[model samples]
Target: MSETATVFNQQLAARSAGGSTDAPPPVRHVCVVGGGTAGWMTALMLATTAYGPRLKVTVLESPQVGIIGVGEGSTPWLRGFFDGLGIEESEWMPACNATYKSGITFEGWSTKPGFQRYFHPFASMLDNMTMHQFVDNVHARLEGADVHAHPDRFFVAAALARQGRGPRARPNFPFDIWYGYHFDATLLGQFLAAKALERGVQHLQRHVTQVQLNEQGDIAHLQLDGGEPLAADFFVDCTGFASLLIGKALQTPFVSYAENLFNDAAIAMPTPLGGPIESQTVSTALRHGWAWKIPLSNRHGNGYVYSSAHCSADEAETELRRHLGLLDADVPARHLKMRVGRMENQWSRNCVAVGLSQGFIEPLEATALLFVQRTAAALVEALEQGDLGPAAQQRFNDSMRTRFENTRDYIVAHYKTNSRTDTDYWRANAENMRLSESLQGVLMTWLSRKPLAAGLKAGRFGGGYPIVSWYALLAGMGIFPDPRELQPPTSHQARHRLDAVDDFVARSATNFPDHRELLAAIPPRVGDKTLQLYLW
Candidate 1:
């Protein structure tokens, strides 16, 4: 056996000496490599402890290594994550130039002649009987209704976004909200880093040039670009695609999901909008790829993700510019070359790979940032139980893999079920495409509008969003699971609910604040400059 492997096993044995029945030793030092959102998030969460002094966290990030700054959309789970960290939105909003993102607008996917779009709104009305009744009314329209009509009219965010409004915490609401945000990813990394450092986590400014394995096959230490080595009992790999520790040193094989997901490259550009900023993200499909328009308080984050095998980067850039005609000159265009896959093991030996180090599933639904937050949360939870012993490490690995697969399945579902044949990219979906077992089953049951089977195990991380979110996207894409089985509301109920919704939507538009106006509410910071990072 390799000397490194031997060392790894020995360390595992020492850590697991207490046996499966006893609580494992506390993690004394955690070395996190990479300082992007993933790295800082891991450090911040891991440094905080119910055990208090049981954990000590350190982050190594290159002052020069730029991060891929493209993801601007997120799910509502972010609010909970921030709350868990005891972070006030106002503390970081100005520094990040953030804006509220209620949901995504999927445009140009239908069998009809002209492209049709639908809003996959954030909050569902299933909680309120009146809203549920309204949804029942809309369900009728969904049954045999005018398919070209905007089904999103029934959604709160879609309606409020149309009026360019943001969300405010309403005490009278049935549920708080279903909202996320659009911000500069690089800025967010810096914001998290500052917070992490303030909370007693050590930050090292250096690039990892080499990862050394000890005699037992575990990561023993990593050498910096031009400095001494840093070692720790546990390591969290957030080094983006380099996967220096997990993939290179630990030699964990990667499981590709390329066949199921088509788009491989993305071209991103940021454009500053001076007018009233919109508080919604719009994802429109093109002939060969898809384009995302994420609105921020100060600017719009736009990108085109395409299959590089089908089209060149130059062509994609031109296409993106054509779509965004009024783009500013200062908004330089950049390209992100990526793969859609996950590592065979996210947590292997004494190391765990998070963010792009583990793998990337493209930036379709903005799962990248949220994935980091969730992974950090899971790691924190596991560490709180004790150190990353074999059992805990295995559980962590399983959970990360499950989350990646779930995200991959959902992204693949979007492309595989697309009925549009406008271009070669769209036609790719028509081919006999492979699907994960979970996605395959979802596709099958979608034909009947049946809910997911009870006792569904989320495996690793909780599935992003829920099956219902998929149902909305599928229905909007014209991939009716069971059109005949769809229920419609009664006549009187339908009319009454529609009228109430119309009134509610109208009132919401009038009352809601504009995106830029909300940002202006923030107290101005002296010498606040926007941070930019380049990801090649």
Candidate 2:
């Protein structure tokens, strides 16, 4: 078993022996309030045999509340979640109008004129010699070489994405390319709800009118709209921003990231695919905030996330339409107000909050679904480790806080390193914004040298993005140290490596099929059987 699992098991054994004799019994009955991605994902995760031998999972969803449904992009970790559930990509991909995502393409984030683009590919940098290649590029840059000419060319997935292609059926690639999905969020909720119900998770379509607290201040029972009061040993609050159970009832304090992340609202709309669909999420920096374009198999999910302090909703929508070249086209748009923060304690007493109820950063990197997956997995691990006592709850809270803060730092790095000075928003984010102490320190260190993997480790559950991710964002935004800080590579070796990179790019462009063609070639699954589709 992995070290993390071993440690968790050890903690569980210790807790079961003598820790907190007065603590509540091992959580067997779990009531998840609110049914969308968060609720169903939590229910289904707990319903697994790994967690469900003595556990009963139920989901209480309100018929009156509508789903926010704007989250369309996801990180590659989602693929592991599906695999754990024994769910085939063919089973959910078509059902969700899903398309493979190589990674995100960031545009116009630099101060350079015209459009400057960079790729944050999903492929694991650990397996690939990314850092070594970065070192070579740094040496080249010091020698006045045009090393910035397609920095992402070394990444196979990024190269595929640039050519409007997906992963190819090749055996001898340098590294395995990782990919996620772009799908309809509403359909995803329906798909997960179906899976959860199939796995014996009871679903109640009723509004929660009241929350009853125990003597110790933990949630005891919930009063439904027209049914008997529902009670459980533990509760999960998936009620989105309402945070009915964790926020309103538990009164968990919130820590806002607004000081670093200025965007507070988003206007989302779906537009018909005017042409061939792209194989990645495209985030274009706009005048005020930014616009995201996620291309699903059916339609393109587009949104403008902007600072309410800098621009009005109407103005943001206009800018979005203008950027999408849809100013003359009439498409319905939904305006969403977001609270850019996380709860002080995601796990408090007997209740835990997942998804938006726990917190929300702007959807800059599609982290919402990832947090839901991580939180659900963490809760299951805690439950496996005997009773959810103070020790376990504290650990869970600390781990989640680390994850949120780390993610916040990564997202902030995008705006913090941006050189755009055209608008007030850009100026504030680039020059005047206050960064988290940790981020500031990292930035300071990077000024002297490139970020090293050993130096960037967030021990255990500190929950930062991978070291390569930081490299991509920093190098893409031209945030590097003086090239003279490093020793120059031998002239012969540099030329050979540069030639090899060029050869690889040429071969990759020819080997991969067009993104649209690849999608068209996948045979449709029949009935409900799990088809053996080539996993991305």
User: For every model shown, what is its TM-score relative to the native structure?
Assistant: 0.84, 0.88
lDDT, each prediction: 0.69, 0.77
Once model 1 is optimally superposed onto the true structure by TM-score, how far is the C-alpha of residue 120 displaced, in angstroms?
Answer: 1.2
Q: Candidate 2: how large is its RMSD?
A: 5.9
Q: What is the C-alpha RMSD, rounded to one decimal, of candidate 1? A: 8.8
Writing each residue's lDDT as its tens digit, candidate 2 over 238-302 gives 99999999999989998998898999999998888867677899999999999999999988999
- Provide C-alpha RMSD values for all models, in order: 8.8, 5.9
Task: Let me know the TM-score candidate 1 reaches against the reference structure.
Answer: 0.84
How many pairs of residues collide in each model? 14, 0
Report the lDDT tens digits of candidate 1 across residue range 186-287.
888889899989978998888788889989898888898776899898899998998888998899999877786777889888776766677778888887
Q: Residue 217 in candidate 2 has what lDDT?
A: 98
- What C-alpha lDDT does candidate 1 achieve relative to the native structure? 0.69
